[model samples]
Target: MKKVVSLLALVMLLNGCDDGNLTQEDINFEDIPTQSCSINNIIYKLKDEESLLLEIPETSFTNEPSTVGEPTLLDINSANRVVYRFYNGTVSATNICETIPPATPIVTDQWSAIAGKIQIFTTAVKTTNATDNSTKITGYNHNIVFKNITFAKNNGTQVYETFPFGDYVTTANALPFLFDQTVEQCSASKQIYNYNSSEALLLDIDPSLIVNSATPLNTPRTGLIGTTVNKLTYRLFSGLLTSGYFCTGTIPSTPTVSEEWVATSGVSNVSGIIEVTTTTLGTGFKHVIVLKNVTMKKGTNDFKLGDSFIYGELLTTN
Candidate 1:
């Protein structure tokens, strides 16, 4: 509800396959806890981590302080810093950039989510002032570390706060990831408890609009995906989800296309939607258009009879 686009950024994509480099691996907490210490900055608890903070505390945290190595390709650097340990039993670390300098007054800031000794930590050190004939200024960095620190976690009294609906949508995890096929939950008996609910989506493009309309392409395949294309004007976006991929053909500009999926019986991908069967054409994939919240653009273009377009099904129409 509160404008999240500014803070929780969205990854902008150009029209094409959104295939990111994927290497299947187990989710590891070995790389979970990391910290950033900037002078005069209040560390706000990311809403998702609030619960975990209350569960663990100031003194309850174990300290196996160590030096953090530089993170590869990570925007945040952890070089020459102190590490803070916060885990069920393991220790996590963060680097300390610099500390408050002599003759400078240290300022304190606060933040929180936990009720007990959970605390907000920050310090401000005066920046270096240097200038040369070529440049006008020299800058300074802050140093952040407490003397023999501890994060004690404990609570007998309970507390709760209700955030506005739009302010924070409760996401169990980070974000909605791309379609995946891994089965969650398991047991030693190998009963295959998870029925495999993942599905691969395929989209059809009109031959006329494709760059290779006359190139004699292959038959309709079952593994097509719906990528977003903003160049054309079908204007079918509802909130944030754009379900259909755009078309770009050298010839058949206006093509009639349909979706295909397998009707997964309560245990598969088709179980939640209206799927007819489990083959390429009718295995059970149907066209779906998800509309979040709509607003009109600044200008509208009026054409005669012919206009380029793509279509999707409605949430309720199914």
Candidate 2:
């Protein structure tokens, strides 16, 4: 009776090893870097004789950060698929990426993800300047994860509670900001601006900053960038910024402001200091505005304008 039971146990163990088409039980490509095809939607990771492929919309990975507790969810379906393929021999990116796959590395086993949700948790990746400790957003990292995924093969299906798909990064949009050194002041409001076509640097100056009095040659009049008084702003517009845009009594609704960054509130002479050197220019006074160690900030990201930055010159006829 003991010999018969031992033979039955050995048979059960051998049957368990034949798990349908799943010879490689562990589908681990965690350390491998994800590669994308020319089609853009297809992303895959290749290991020796195995490959894991994902076909999802490129828009799935948004450049913006995902909200905490609420990750971006995408359902696994016909259009969005996850596939694991085992080949007869070693495979390269050409096997999966090319329109016509090579015939040599033929697929031996295949598992298709039948049901699940692809969860993406995204965060902004920033680069900080060593000189001033200012930060700029370089890219965004999208962390991919699979939840309650079920993979179906020829014989049966295998369910996974959770699976990590690793991180995919996308570069941030570049800020095209270039100035021509020419400054214009608003006749209706206490504002001065230096602008290109779509980018503008504006300063809502204090009344005392641009007085007609001539300042000393070396010692210029200094002030702080405050919330209400000496406010400094950098604006990126969607449309062309005409000369009449700021001169209007009310801020125009057209040529909408896409992005805005404000100067960090000053700490006396340390940062955000507005220095104006007033020199007599014919009948009027030329007030050359220079920003000293100014740091511009938008949310958690910030960048400095170096040690000294010229904010252009403003003229007063008083």
Candidate 3:
């Protein structure tokens, strides 16, 4: 029997058959577009008030040749200057017995005593992004300023005018630093020992942004003269400055600084891009390896890579 359908029922049936609506499952998250942005060129200068005081141990000097049971007394004089080699964690005297003219005069009541202080100022330039700015490696130029240093003699005298009294500069490759806003994290690696090791820098970043880009450079192709291809490489170790922890937001009271460095592997040339992956990194920090400029060679042809000028921001989350 034909019956009049209720208005409400008719409406419901029509709505159920409609194909214009989309379900949550039907949405492709991968297809969603992300905003492309770039960080402004920011210069991060180490605060002027901040300084690192490297302490030299009195017991650092030990007698050489056939096990002297006790530590040897370092001679304090103008001719016997204490030479120090500063690494990530420790500082040692470079000249054990060889006595050269002291960079500065050493005066002390005791044979063994604290040597002096090295005042260093470090500054870095963060470069901009090229691709999706949400996740990218930024370029950096690190500058270290060494102030006129003095050594403290145990006898209350000071040795004025030591070594490293100028500015030292090093340039980084395309994205030596990474800022990931999605996770509210930032990370970078500095080559502390050119030809030796790297130091990891970790920090917190703003959580609202995302970036996906790479540091780009160009290299010459061996077979093709004057033909250069874009190649991207990381930074190399310059040298260790001082020990400190890196973080965003509030600085931790007990920031741990680790000197452990793991070498990078699996660097290959894919098309024109150089792909690098690091396996060893400190906990809570993304590790990066310092890479040298790449030179491509096939048979007799070879070329060096070049880079695009880009800059970015390096705000401390803390």
Error of 3 at 34 (Å): 43
- Candidate 3, poorest ten consecutive residues by summed lDDT: 42-51
RMSD list, candidates in order: 27.1, 3.8, 33.7
Model 1, residue 150: what's the lDDT?
25
What is the C-alpha local distance difference test score of each model? 0.21, 0.84, 0.27
Per-residue lDDT of model 1, residues 127-159, tens digit only: 222321111111111112122222222322122
The most accurate candidate by TM-score is 2
Query: For model 3, how does the per-residue alpha-carbon lDDT over 219-257 read when each residue is reduced to its tens digit?
Result: 211111113222222232345423332333453344232
Winner by lDDT between candidate 3 and candidate 1: 3
Q: How many backbone clashes does every candidate have?
A: 46, 0, 38
lDDT tens digits, residues 232-310, model 2?
A: 9998899998877776778789799988889999997688899999999999989899988888877644667767788
RMSD of 1: 27.1
Q: Report the CA-based lDDT of candidate 1 relative to the real structure.
A: 0.21
Instruction: Show the lowest summed lDDT stretch of 10 residues, model 2.
Output: 17-26
